[model samples]
Target: MTDLLDPVSPDRAESFLTDHFQGVLVRPGDRSYDEVRAVWNGMHDRKPELIARCTGAADVSVALRYAVAAGRAVTVRGGGHNVAGTAVSDGSVMIDLSLMNRVDVDAGALTARAQGGCLLRDVDSATLAHGLACPAGVVSHTGLGGLALGGGYGWLARKWGLTCDHIVAAEVVLADGSIVEATEDDHAELLWGLRGSGGNLGVVTRFTLRLRPVGPVHHRTGVFPLADAAAALALYREFAERQGPDLHAVATLKIAGQQDWIPERLRGTPALFLTATWFGESAEGPEHTAPLFATAAPDAVLTRLLSFAELQALGDHGEPHGNRYYTKSCYLTDLTEGPVGQLLDATREIASPLSAIDFEYLRGAIGDVPDEDSAFPRRDAPYICTVSAQWTDPAEDAGHRAWSRRGVERLAEWHFGGAYVNYLQDEQPGKVAEVYGSARYARLAALKRRYDPENVLSGNQNISPAAP
Candidate 1:
């Protein structure tokens, strides 16, 4: 990685920016820089000398060329939702993509064109109008660029695969300032590297995503009372094993104050909120999965068939743009007893009032994809676990972070030692290699060397060439 600690001074930075770009160029003293530098997480306090709000790919290329020529570090900012605050840096050229929020849907081809800056909800809202949808992040405000590049997962994942799986092509600005379109037929190797590779390759300006016809579907949600955290976890482990592609479900042990839907008994206790969505008829899904839920008598049942749009909206309640949140996620091949016990035991000790332990079932369409076909190699993974700790104060940040880390440590003994990069926050850089696995990590690093040899886009879950 380049030395980003000492960027060019503000005068030179503004002068270089003004000479090449016609869009807004903000500096430290500018009133807009304060707001522009503020990312999704209020915890970050970076002071980039310049922030260039690019108007299009041409402007992006210009910025990239300038950063390299001047030997300056550059950080790309989409929705800026990365919990690690990778979108901004202390002394770097912040390429703000917020101005590139545009969505174009091709109804005939069943695809959507999303600029790098658009959020999940932006694409969903546009595609749903045409009775179509694409796999994206669960949070509505997450940037399409960062999510897709890092292999996004959501409710539609089990049915349609991950966001990277739906990508048809992407327009990327390479290290030396050239623009290229990467797809299966053209720049195929780069396309393969782009998926699940984070932003180590290049700055993706736009993406052509595959879309599926998602009509009205059955949405069954239940909040089970948690008299026994161990029993609830065991039941969830069993239920996830039998779930099919049509059924997308997650079990979250959340704090009482987060939602009113939680059962009174489980309100302030360690409980499970199992939400399932089936794309087909409500009756069929319920009948197929009824035995699983029966394992533990649920205190509240909020199951019913609703439109696919409504189910997407249900998760919208959790805002993606703000609120101090720390998360750790991992993929597992099975819910072994030892790991399951450790998970339940860890959840019982959460000190934060806004923390939660979540289990997202991974099977069906997601599991059907070949490991080497795209950058995502976790097809064999049956489950993805996440510990999300959210709060509203800086003083409470350390406590929540420690709570999440402890959960990860407790579950580490039982896991396969792999994780989901998109859910990683404030963890070691080595976690990047752990998430992608050694063999695949080497391939990703080589690809990173080919496309971003200078490490121009090193702000993300970084990948560099292997040592000689």
Candidate 2:
């Protein structure tokens, strides 16, 4: 065994790793090392000592065992889309699962099994081909593993619940280099913890998710001038509270850019945008979305029936890879005037044109799930507020981050003090407890102790092992 923290002879390490590993191995000076290390967020620029491009569960187990024997820190990468960039670390053993992307859809069973590296698009393309869909994140390029583990929500959440809610089973690689299948009947507690506690207990090699029959959906997008944003938000709040499970909506405050949806006059101006989707009849969508148009009298309105995959793809353009991204978010108990005003004030001083304040309406099926069903605890939150700062210039990082922090602080009074763990960045400390309350966190820690006693998997939103 070698000390992973201390410097070891490269020739010896490379030879040893090559003798034991079957997948592709890249050392520090390898030609593709830089490309392998680049994740979705440009904020993290780390150089791992070794990169193991695992092909399957066997490869993952081999890598983990080797890392444990060598006493090296390990990080896992699946689609490499984490905003916090926990997938890569300096001088660590990076288990790159990007090559393991394989999706198998069983229409007969109404379920889909995806490898750990499969992105949302990979699963969507396969399942949608069969006219079936799974609840997943909005961004098509995001890794399904991280999103599902952190409680996935998107256009279909109101109708079918979160991505984690639909997960029937998962194949996980435990810390002790053993593989196990977690389902309702076997290793059930571990399965419950995996629903929302993030990549804390172990590395999931594959996920088996329940699928639902989904067809074309009615989509409505409205853009209103900044002057009428407050009134529009109030109307939206009222409508969202009373809306049915088949309808899902989002309110966004952003500097209108050159998007095709935005009218020419609204471009480059501060504006409020409302987007609503109806999973049922197309005719009913306009009825549910009429209140937004009546309130804001938007400059432009685009409503049409679109395929489910197309609706999911819409989020891809706004959030592209290689851009510096920072986010501050909280789950709001309600959307009252005070918090709305604070959000507006925060948006008034936007650091970058790409920056925006977003609100996602939550309830219906999301809240129907009991609090103790999974590690995710904030089921009663009616909405979630996020201040997303995106910029291309590295020099402007400080201003943008500070702006987001201040925005979250101003709206703290209206929030439940809990945040979506998936959206959390590296800078937010002590957030694990907030995301999962004390009782739930304690339960997760106990599970962590049983599955990973030494805390070998501490690269993610970690839950420390409970004391004996």
Candidate 3:
């Protein structure tokens, strides 16, 4: 690997780049350089040699051409919200796409086209204006490019399916600085690879996503005493299995905090929380969720009608950017008693008050899609167990990370042997293959050879090109 840190005269590089580029070129000491380099995870404080703030697909091509010609490592930053912090790297040419956030909604066609740099909130706000939305992540601040490319899931997933399932077309800048549109009839293979492979083949400049009719939903959230966790989880599993496609829910285990909704005595105590949303009429939500409240006997419960956008923003307050984060996750084949016990035990050792163990219910429309339809292949799993650790103090990093790791290890026996690519924090060898399986990884590698033969876009969860 060539050292991207090798000295290149700033004036010469900037002049050459600006001559053909329509975007700003930033260097180490330039104003806004630090702001551009910062990512969602505060743990990565990398210093890139140059930052190319791209305005459009042409600007992306120029940046890629510059990186290839200079023989420098290239890192692409869309929203800079990936937990792994792969968007920016030390001693690399950072292609910053934060400036290219433009959303175009075709209400008549029920589709929306968003630029690479748009956040979940950007797409949601635009699509909701037409009373339609695409299935995406819960946090509004997360980048659309990363989440969708990694097979997005949210409240709408149970009804409409994942974000990848809604993708109709994409505009991509390939490794050779060529721009092309990937649709079912065009560069179709690339589109298949992009659905869940995490941006290894090219820089996606725009994504045209199919939208569905969505509006205010009945949202229910509640926190129960720790003693009720076992019963609550059991009831949740039963409810998830019996519920219709319109129901999307999550059950989380964590220590309660100073929220006004939590009882004063229950604050700072370990608790189990159940959150559910009904995509259909708000009036029917209570009937569907009444069983859960009856079984768990929560200490607090809040149920109301909220816009789809508001429901998406529910988790944002707890997960502010700039907090150090580490996560380990796996798909659950079954939520058996043994794994549930392990999770409860792990929660007892929480290192930070902000840390949590979350289990998302998966079924209905998500399972209706064939596994081979896209690169995302864990359709058989019933749930995804994520152990997330977050903190502000650098000194608490080791403890929190260890807690997360142990939690995953304890529950490994119940895992389906597949992991969510978006939740992956480190580049463990064989991890990609484990996530996608051998056959799908082989197909992805072949696609990589076709579109990114030299591996110019290797900064992400990379799938190397197949041997010639």
Candidate 4:
């Protein structure tokens, strides 16, 4: 039987939380409630009634079951980097695993078992000690659990596949409160859904990832002043097509004055920055990258070979929480003049300093993989572009959000008909259907019905169960 608590009663919610939860659960008046409710993006301002800080797999199981038994919405949090703030829900029970950050590396099997709450930095530090690395996201603080679940592709993606590709096994707590081990040999179908399923099926308690030997290498960042956005886009396309699998680059359109690397006058203008990493040795990287740099006059050329750990932290710091964030992304087929012109048109209207755009080239190990091998089906899409807009005042929310939409709207005609699910913001209920193709979406929907028929986990890019 389920326990019935008063909808407006904190004491009622706290009683069951403290009694059964092995970790801390904060409420409205609690001292740490405010801080615990905050997430990575400054945009998300949700106030859940109970914030349960889970400790282990058992703790996660208890939290989910308790939410069901108590009739409360549940939000599973890890690194809390979901740009849409799906990690926390308003007036719900937040199952936070931020404290369960443990990484175990097994050299004999060339695999690492990473806890759900472990950050990318923790995984890198642990795996790099053995000269091994796996494909992860760019941000160091991004959680391994969410990243792997969403099909992570980082600098190492060219040589190694996305984070999902390296997933050897997973320990998941199903919606019915059963612990299941998903791998290739056993429960294979569930493992297929986990890749890029975005947390719909279960809460992944642990991930066993395949690792490869990666040298302590240098990360190279180059810049070209954005005088003509069209030319920059053309050059990037040409270079990326010819660049072999060893090299990787992401083309960013920044709001000129953000970085000290650009000249004073060029500040606040649209500029192109090429950030790449050479997994082998830093000295040999420039030779391959010279072609791309030669396409335009150099604004800044700062290249140094640093340790893998140092390389990962470049241009990364803590993001302020409690700000309004609106982001949208899509996969692009090309970076031609028409698309570049559309991007520039949208750039001119961005009013917020926090507004910026990025065009991440998708190739190498990411695009080279078979489409059917994983749930991230967009293998032919060459580019992933994202518009991230942020603002402080609630009144300014409309304008910032408009800018984000306009940026993509301008390229609507050129859209590849698919998007990156992780980067999607709130939109039509069928948004996930648009991001993943209709066929793949249907397959995923059926799978969701099998694993989570009641839709207990619907916070992510949700996959609702099929009708009976």
Worst 10 residues of 3 by lDDT: 1-10
The TM-score values for the models, in the order shown, are: 0.92, 0.95, 0.96, 0.92
Per-residue alpha-carbon lDDT of candidate 2 for residues 151-178, written as tens digits (9 for 90 to 100)? 9988888888899888899999988778
- Which scores higher on TM-score, 1 or 3? 3
TM-score of 1: 0.92
Q: Which stretches of model 4 miss by more than 4 angstroms? A: 1-19, 258-260, 318-322
Query: Candidate 2 clashing pairs?
Result: none
For lDDT, candidate 1 versus 3, the one ahead is 3
> What lDDT tens digits, residue by residue, belong to model 1 across residues 1-468?
222223444446445555668678888899788988988876777998678898888788777766765667899998898888888999888989998988999999998889988878788889999989997776677788888888888888887888998889999888766789998899998999888888778888899999998877666566665555557667767777777777777777765544565555566666667666777665677776565567776766776677766776666566445578788877665676787776767777877666788876687787777888777766777777888788888898888888888887777655656677766666676877777778888888888778877677888778776521
In what order do the candidates fall by lDDT, top score first? 3, 2, 4, 1
The candidate maximizing TM-score is 3
Residue pairs with colliding backbones in model 1 are none
Q: Once superposed on the true structure, which residue ranges of model 3 sit more than 4 Å away at CA?
A: 1-15
- Output the better candidate (2/4) by lDDT: 2
The RMSD (Cα, Å) of candidate 4 is 3.5
Candidate 4 shows a clash count of: 7
Error of 2 at 171 (Å): 0.7
